[model samples]
Target: MTSPTTPGVPPPVVDLDLGGRTALVTGAASGIGRACALRLAAAGAKVRAVDRDADGLETLAALGTEAGGAVEPQVLDLTDLDAAEAAAAGADILVNNAGLQLVRPIEAFPPDVFHTVLTVMLEAPFRLIRGALPHMYAQGWGRIVNISSVHGLRASAFKSAYVAAKHGLEGLSKTAALEGAPHGVTSVCVNPGYVRTPLVERQIADQAAAHSLPEDQVLADVLLKDSAVKRLVEPEEVAEAVLYLCTPQAAFITGTSIALDGGWTAH
Candidate 1:
């Protein structure tokens, strides 16, 4: 037989089959969330793509259709806690990825923005997990993947809200893992350093202003300063980690975080 591996092409990280699984991915309109949604769909899971961006959801749905994957777009703003919880019901796999950020000094940070950030990033996840747990417990098989960040493990200046929320998420994830273990469900966090996404792109301006540097210099002197890899993580890489967690081989891997931080945490 010819070589099983195609030259210059890497094989899939995991040979996972989720044929009858129903996966719910928040922020599915873009970036890591979108990558996870599509990856799950490609693996035969029926993906419910949730995002507030109707146009983006449409685009994702179209792309999913073209790839012959089942992706149903759910236009939702995760801030609406009731609806967010309701939308999560019956999901076998839940990826809590929707988030917003504001880079500012603690004293200068707007209280309203702080509240909004926690509401969307932290509270919404609590509700979503609450809704998903019943079905997961009943089925005795479920995956709860929380998209956290390196900030969850380490603190950085001018990212008060994001860091605080991520820290809280890590604790929440561990708690869920403890509770869900008896039910055969797993909860884990995937922490990436700084992924190239619209969220990071938007932060460049604020980061520049905060550090008194040119926008171009923010990536080198600021964002990647502590990263040994000296480059941004890709959304697909993070998505792959999330996918691996949902596999049977990862059944015992719970209550912890997979850090894709480019050695940021090693410091």
Candidate 2:
């Protein structure tokens, strides 16, 4: 008899074919969004990479060119809710990944910043989903992946705006899943812990200041303190999870969150 494959020795590899599909990814100019945009395009989908950073988008498009993937950069700020909705029109796969963060105690948090976070992370996704659903329902297939955070499931201090926005996104994702089930559409959330993104890099300073810690101590002491894995998750790793959700194998895996938090929530 052949020996059984060792558990977790070599991770399972997924092969997906998304030929002729169109995917829209927000915040596609950098970090997790950029990774997802390229990953989807590599699977033969036409990826509409949306971001406010024109230069970053150009770089992303160029990277796609090197990968022999299709990436169409769309420069638009998600704060413009109407524009966000319009951009999602005719998308077969929608990845709502655009977000901003402000690290301050609830009392010290700027009301305007909180409002902006809600607009970009929650309302914009609602509008985009609303815009994408009609075409998806007509075609009988769709995927909506929200790039949430471990914060969505749990809470942390000094991150009022981000935590609230992510929690709202979780509810929205689940509701979309229920409504879209019969229409052959699926909505899911990919919740990651501290990712090795520019956003997190910038946060180190803010977090250090907020927690009264040295910059170097922020990662291990603050970010990864509750995580079983003592490392930041790579953007490519999160992108892989996003790609898997778009695969046919994940058709039934809707209305749920796939946590890529390295056992952060296990605690």
- Best model per lDDT: 2
Tens digit of per-residue lDDT, candidate 2, span 51-92: 999999999999999999999999999999999999999999
| lDDT of each residue in 1-267, candidate 1, tens digit only | 435486633354555988999999999999999999999999899999999999999999998999889999999998899999999999999999999999999999999999999999999999999999999999899999999999989999998999999999999999999999999899999999999999999999989999999999999999999999999999999988998899876888999999999999998
lDDT agreement with native, every candidate: 0.94, 0.95
Total backbone collisions, model 1? 0
Off by over 4 Å in 1: 1-15
Structure candidate 1, residue pairs in collision? none
The reply for model 2, stretches above 4 Å from the true place, is 1-15
After aligning candidate 2 to the native by TM-score, how far in Å is the CA of 151 from where it should be? 0.3
RMSD of each: 5.4, 4.6
Q: What's the TM-score of every candidate structure?
A: 0.94, 0.95
Residue 131 deviation, candidate 1, in Å? 0.2
Q: Give Cα distance to truth, residue 120, candidate 1, Å.
A: 0.7
